[model samples]
Target: MDWVVKFARSSIGAKAVVALTGAGLVGFVVAHLLGNLQLFAGPEQFNNYAHGLKSLGPLLWAARLGLLGMFVLHIGMAIRLQSMNKAARPVSYQSKKAQASTLASRSMLLGGVTLLLFVLFHLAHYTLGVVDPQFLEYKTAEGWHDAYKMTVIGFQSAPVAGLYIAAMAGLAMHLGHGVSSMFQTLGLNHPRYRPLIRGIGPALAALIFLGFVSIPIAVQLGIISLQGGA
Candidate 1:
């Protein structure tokens, strides 16, 4: 419809779309972290969890596709909104001061780009079996994919683990600002609750960062390994 197209082209609508898609992505991130935490349960439990998800077959692919769509829309709208903002102010300011902007907010674009590259590398390393094909060949006694073994062995490389840690830190910074911005865009930032709402973003970002990076850190510390210690 014309109205739909017009709304989508408007800055407000673009922001709304970004906010909603970002919320969806955040939900996925939390769910993914929870699933990843199964590694602490040892090989059998982690393998079973991976197998269960793979057993979904078509459903799994559908979920992936849905997530991919949301990711694309979120990034696309964000870039478009940035362009619109720049176009509205073609002339550069004589001097700029970040009185109200935080470092995370100022570096959102760079952080987004970094995260995008990390996501692609992650997919190649774990999902596609491109980084290390031998990992995919690993199988448990039950014949299920040895995801636990793969994970432990994959992070054995200090470089790989360091990259993951750094990426997670970047993710935390992005989410710290992005989450609060999403709430404000959605009009949930009431004066009475603004402080609490703003705090939620950084708190959640820290939790997610810890949750994700814990896997690699535990691997490096030998707390989680193929030796059945974890």
Candidate 2:
């Protein structure tokens, strides 16, 4: 167990864990964005999509729990690494220049923590019954929450939609740094394709952010309504 902890704390090993987890999360975001995209198709389509997920019953919950666990572990490691880095900054270096890290990279750790806070609020508003819920009783035939209707209701609020946009913005900031770093951590930073890594990372992050944020923006713009449509 001691050696396990030590290995996890090592720079290379820590980066390996971060890279693997970050890559997995990118895949998840893609799927989620695709699913959410149905809102543009209309309510019936979006509802049907949500309903389909609920139909999976225990299987859906199991998948959610597994993903939640992985998310927690990934976040914990990130927080740990960030803390270590902050602590290592010399105390007596009073005249130190403050321009070492690019703003995006320097603040990703902070944005991640803020994003975590947003997630909790989001789950409560849209999923859990803890907060002012979007749909009180979207119960499925198998007693699962009617996730489709709930999603529609939650995004109906102009304010909520705006906040979601902000949260996705934060997600983009984190991913902008994360994607390229992940490839580097995984030893994929070949000199021949370094440009590819740099270019693709921001592009992918932009797509993910834009896809997720668009639904809310469209709703707020009145270009679409979530009420009776998907």
Candidate 3:
């Protein structure tokens, strides 16, 4: 029990937890983006995809609960570690140099908070259907959830689309720093391949941000629609 308490309070253990959870989250983000890309395939295709997930019943709920737990763990540890870091510092350096650290790294807390807000709004808009009443009753001809039409209707609002795009930028910033930092935390830092490892984060962030923002942008631009032939 003492050892467990010590480890939980230690910086190293915090970093390890962050690293593992961050890696898992990155995988989830990739999968989620891929699944959402079904919007481009049109209504029936997208609705069928949504139906398939719903058909999973308990398995889908289990996955959702597991993902929720992971998010809670990751967010809790991040705030805890940040507080620890600040407490240890207590005072700012009179002359902080911006030598090796990037802007994304420096703004991790901001990015994380922004992403958290976005996630809440997103879940409300899509999962809970509490954000937009109009999209709540959408259904396909076959009685499946009309996820495609809902997406189209939701993103049709310029403000909604703009907010989504902005949130994705925050997500990109978070991931840009998080991916490389996780590798370093896990001690994958080899001098020879440090640059390559660091580059992976930004690359992945860009890809994900592009993929996510593309959806809202496409919907707003009328390049994708509920029916076939956008």
Candidate 4:
């Protein structure tokens, strides 16, 4: 019991938890992107995909709950670690210089907080449809929820699209730092593969940012439209 408590209270333990949870979130991001990419195909395809996810029923709720748990753990530990770091170094350096830290690394706290807010906004905008009445109470001809229409309508406005793009920029920066740190936290960083591992973070972040922002940009540019069954 003492060991358990000690481990739970330790910084290393917190870092490990963050790494593991971050890995789960990265997987979710990729999977979510793939699912949404169905939009480019057509409404039938996208709506059907949505229906399939809804058809999961209990499994869907399970996944959502699991993801929620991961978010709570990741954020909680991250804040704790940050506070510990600050408390450990209460005095500011007279001549401070960051040799290894990048801008993304330094802004992790800001980016993480920004991303948390963005996620809540995103869920409200699309998941709960609380932000826009247009996203709410919409059904397709086949009696399914018209996700394609809702998505297009939500992103059609220049303001909404701009916010999404800005949020994505923060997400990309946060992800770039978080992903690379995971390997170091997990003891997977190797000298032989350090270059590759370091590059993977920003590259993956860029990929996700591009994938997600493209939909809104496409909708704004008229490449995707409700009339065209997007």
Task: Give the best candidate by TM-score.
Answer: 1
Tell me how many clashing residue pairs each candidate has.
Answer: 0, 5, 0, 0
Worst 10 residues of 1 by lDDT: 95-104
- Each candidate's root-mean-square deviation in Å? 1.6, 3.2, 2.0, 1.8
Candidates arranged by lDDT, highest first: 1, 4, 3, 2
Per residue, candidate 2 scores C-alpha lDDT tens digits across 1-230 of: 99888889876666677778888888888998899888777756776787788789899999888788778878877767767666787553444364435355567877687688898988788767676643767765556555655666667787888888888888888888889878888889999999999888789889988888888777666656635443
Error of 2 at 86 (Å): 3.8
Model 4 agreement with the true structure over 1-230: per-residue lDDT tens digits: 89866876789988998999999999998999999888888888899999999999999999999999999999998888878777887775444344245344568888888999999999999999889876768899988889988998888889999999999999998999889889889998989989998999999999999999988888888888886644
Model 1, runs deviating above 4 Å: 94-105
Q: RMSD in angstroms, candidate 3?
A: 2.0
The model with the greater lDDT, 2 or 4, is 4
Candidate 3, after superposition: displacement of residue 42 in Å?
1.1
Residue 139 lDDT in candidate 2: 66
Give Cα distance to truth, residue 170, candidate 2, Å: 0.4
| Candidate 3 residue lDDT tens string, 130-189 | 987767688788877788888888998899999999999999999998998899998999
Per-residue alpha-carbon lDDT of candidate 1 for residues 54-91, written as tens digits (9 for 90 to 100)? 99999999999999999999999999998897798777
lDDT of each: 0.91, 0.76, 0.85, 0.88
Clash pairs (backbone) in predicted model 2: 42-229, 42-230, 43-229, 43-230, 138-146
